[model samples]
Target: MALSVREQIADNSRIDILSAAARCFMDRGYAAASIDEVARSLGATKGRIYHHFPSKADLFAAVFRHGMDLNYEAVRPFIDLPGSALPRWRRMAMSHVLLMIDTKPFQRAVWIGVEMHLRGATTPEQRSVFNELIEYRHNYGMLFRNTLLQGREEGVFRFDDLSITNQLMFMTLNSPIFWYTPRVGETRSDVEGVAKKVVEYALGGLSKRREEGV
Candidate 1:
């Protein structure tokens, strides 16, 4: 089926508005960003922005959701593969850190999330968007929990409480977002090495006696 020019333009305009809104939210924060600024950034009119997103809050929510979806998609394949949990965990952590470094939009969205949490969102929709991000975090936590359980069952890992272990693992894997930066001389391999070190440290205490030697 062939699409009309108007439909194609509309689709492109909606994507432009979403991208602009994401950048504005990251730069100015949700409460301070206006629809006009987003439209201007997209080189479009406020009417176009409003056509795609009823309000700025709605646009921000869309951005948040999009970011979460992206992260999940990146990690899903590694997490779901059949293997010992430790290897999969390492793969997932490496992929996640690399994605955060490579994808500027994801990085911006994460920064916006941090800002929103600190300042608190102004509207119900914004608050809901933040909560959804929290929920995504929780979902990641659950994946960690399952991995820990699988490792424990195989007598390959030891943990006192699945819940606490999950929290600590999540913290360790996600800490790159706060501390990682690309140095002038840094290579992709260097970033992956750091990610592997984090995974090893997180899993070291839980690993079986023999596996720890490796």
Candidate 2:
């Protein structure tokens, strides 16, 4: 039921290694980031990194998987909430935006992993895990897709092409990752404010107009 002391230390070491590797991969693309660089960033020898991860590709894939795991953990509660589809969708979308802004580097790594698959196999040994990641992404998208479809059926949303609208929403949500830099005095409230605005703007595109008092 509990991790032994040795296991705990090993777990912490793995996290440290992954965190350093993630920042390295995020700062530079996965193709350019090397194990040595990650080791240097951690102020440890390459052997330290190698003890945890066998190769650069393994480290990169772990970072990508961590990002996906965070994403799932963030939105699962909201998605499981009861009541109307639109409200649940809004909560899930808002949570997603907040997760993205708060975990910018990890989120960036997630996108980089997505793009990496397009350029062909860079990590042949980890291709199976990469494919699993793709399936995980599709399942994640389906959370929104299915909710949006239900919202459309309920007259809460209007869109002709489900896939296109979903893509548009994702693009809008992910845009902040590209340009968002936290301000000096910004608080969690400020971040949430921005996230709220983003959710409203994105959902506005799909919302159906209603007559006054109707």
Candidate 3:
């Protein structure tokens, strides 16, 4: 259904707030991030953010959730595709790599949120929100875990331990965020080419057949 004008405006503001907040967290660590900083970045007042979120933790949580949603949006279609899981997994990997590059700030916020959780830097309330995100992340991981199991059953991929292999796959796929930056004149094709290389490298580490032929 189409959004009404009021709802559209509200949604737009929410997205703008999330984008600005993501950058705020990226520019300053979460411990140092504030709604005022986010509002200043948006050239608005803290009241503008409070209209949508009650606290900095909630705003940060919303940003993290939005980032996860972007990843799901990027790869869910490929996950639902018919036929072999192995090939679909490659597409999923490529889709995720592209998202990491395209949405680096949001993705970086994701990593920062994880760090906050690990350091126990968040309050009880923040921890509550982070826990929900943790569950959401687990659910997302399960999607890929199912695909890996399918590929293994079909003898399409080889791995000794499912959990270790899954973690390794993600470390490789998510590593681009640590080092990638868009070239001065980069195009969609250029990004895709980089994503393709990352996926191929990931596959090569996990399965010989993928690098050799698939």
Candidate 4:
């Protein structure tokens, strides 16, 4: 199938707008961001943005969804690899942390959205998109849950309650968002090291104690 120039231009324009919207939303929280500013950032006109997204809310949702999609894609490969749960968890943590550092705009947009949702920013479409994103987020949680179950079955992990343990593991893995910062001297490798340490601490608690006890 051959593509037309007009179609390619349209697709590129949409991507540019979304990228610009992401940056603008990150720099100036979504509530404070204006479509005009995003359009100007993209060297675009408001009409171009409207051509792609009918409303400001719609554009925000699109940017948020795009970020979620990127997260899903980044973590998807490691979810089901053949390994102990701990190793997989470590990989997921490092992957996510590095992603937060590398994909600044996406990460910032996500954090902004999180704050907004916590503050009751709920319209019908926004609510629907948020619910869907929450469900999508469950994919990562499910990986942790299944990994815990697997480790338990293998007698490697001993937890009293699978549900609570899974939740706790996810909570620990997600801490990077709260505390991580890439300063002038900090490197991605540094973040990865921290992620590994976090995974180690979490897995250590979950692992069964040896009978001989050190």
TM-score of model 4 relative to the true fold?
0.76
Model 4 per-residue lDDT at 27:
79
Ranking by lDDT: 3, 2, 4, 1
Question: Highest lDDT among the candidates is held by which one?
Answer: 3
The per-candidate count of clashes, in order, stands at: 0, 0, 0, 0
Error at 46, model 3, angstroms = 1.6
lDDT of 4 by residue, 90-119 (tens): 677567656655666866787677677778
Two-way lDDT contest, 1 vs 2, winner: 2
How displaced is residue 43 in candidate 3, in Å?
A: 1.1
Tens-digit lDDT track of model 2 for 63-178: 88888888899999887677788899988999899988987888898889888787765557667888988788878888887788888899888889999998899988877888
* Residues forming the 10-long window of minimal summed lDDT in candidate 3: 205-214
Error of 3 at 6 (Å): 0.8
Of candidates 3 and 2, the better by TM-score: 3
Alpha carbon lDDT of residue 182, candidate 3? 84
Worst 10 residues of 1 by lDDT: 98-107
The estimated TM-scores of all candidates read 0.73, 0.92, 0.93, 0.76
Q: How displaced is residue 15 in candidate 3, in Å?
A: 0.1
Off by over 4 Å in 3: 209-214
In candidate 3, position 212 carries an lDDT of: 67
lDDT by residue (124-201, candidate 1, tens digit) is 656766777768756855765676788888777887887777767766766666577678998878877877787787
